[model samples]
Target: MDRSSDAPPHPAQALPVPAWQGTWRFTLPPIDSSVPQARHAIRDLLRRRAAPLSAERTHGLMLILSELVTNAVRHAALLTPEIGVEVTVDPHWAWVRVEDGHPYRPHALAASPERQRTGGRGLLLVQATAQEAGGSCGVRATAGGGKVIWAVLPLDRPTGRPATSPPPRSAP
Candidate 1:
């Protein structure tokens, strides 16, 4: 019998799940100080995610987002009046992607005698934070002659000793 051809397809070939299921987008004017704005936007988005994130994780996410936005602003050529930063967060991961209007490919600067003085530490910072949070970072060229710098942070809550309770108060 030729019944094998009529069998249902395997489910293992289905598309993989997205790391971040919820998405938020922001548009900021092309300016030198857009990093701070990006950080604030990320903070607000993280708050909306309703995760019990520690201060260290929150700070790390903000710093990494700011660095990525700053790198895009400084390196990419601006065509439109605004640049966009897209943030995506899910229960297991968070990511920040910055889009600019330049066609340059993002590259990590190698440590060298001459290159070190050019102030190219932003990418390093992003990479470091991502690794620390058990995640990764990368970049890709956009379709409209632009580039996107992205960094992902794992949302895995730390597992170890229980959190310490506040000390007892003495009677007044």
Candidate 2:
């Protein structure tokens, strides 16, 4: 997605222009504190703007943002002293991106039962959460030689159901 409010609306929704329809950006020094700060700020911005996202969607987005910022702090702090965060929402979708000046592009590890570890699975969780919510995520190289990890999700639930409800059951 373009991460701009001007992006086209989803075909099914004819939503009116929301108060939160715009792109917002932030730059923070890569540090442990920046993780929560970034998440909180984004949360507050969305709430203050009265974003149409459901609580579940907002929470999922926050988790993705936290993981991205925490990764940047842990892995890229030395090379990239600053981290960039961006949030954008239109009537149909919401986008979150975290950028750092590291050249390495990390991939989400595949989920498995045998792998026993407490850490190094942030990206995997990010991918799974996004996919479950009918969204997509990936990394892209920035013009400055850095990488931006991003996720884009719909403003409304994709399954035509409430966000907190389970996906419809399949017939036997």
- Predicted model with the maximum lDDT: 2
15-133, model 2: which lDDT tens digit per residue? 56557888999899998999999999999999999888899999999999999999999999988978999998865667888999999999988757897777888999988888887
The sequence of per-residue lDDT tens digits that candidate 1 reaches over residues 120-164 is: 877877877877776678777677877777777666462244323
Positional deviation of 106 in candidate 2, in angstroms? 0.3
Cα-based lDDT at residue 98, candidate 1: 83
**What TM-score does model 1 achieve against the real structure?**
0.72
List where candidate 2 sits over 4 angstroms from the true fold.
Answer: 1-17, 157-172
Candidate 1: regions farther than 4 A off:
1-21, 113-118, 158-172
Per-candidate TM-score against the hidden true structure: 0.72, 0.79
Which one wins on TM-score?
Answer: 2
Clashes of 1: 0
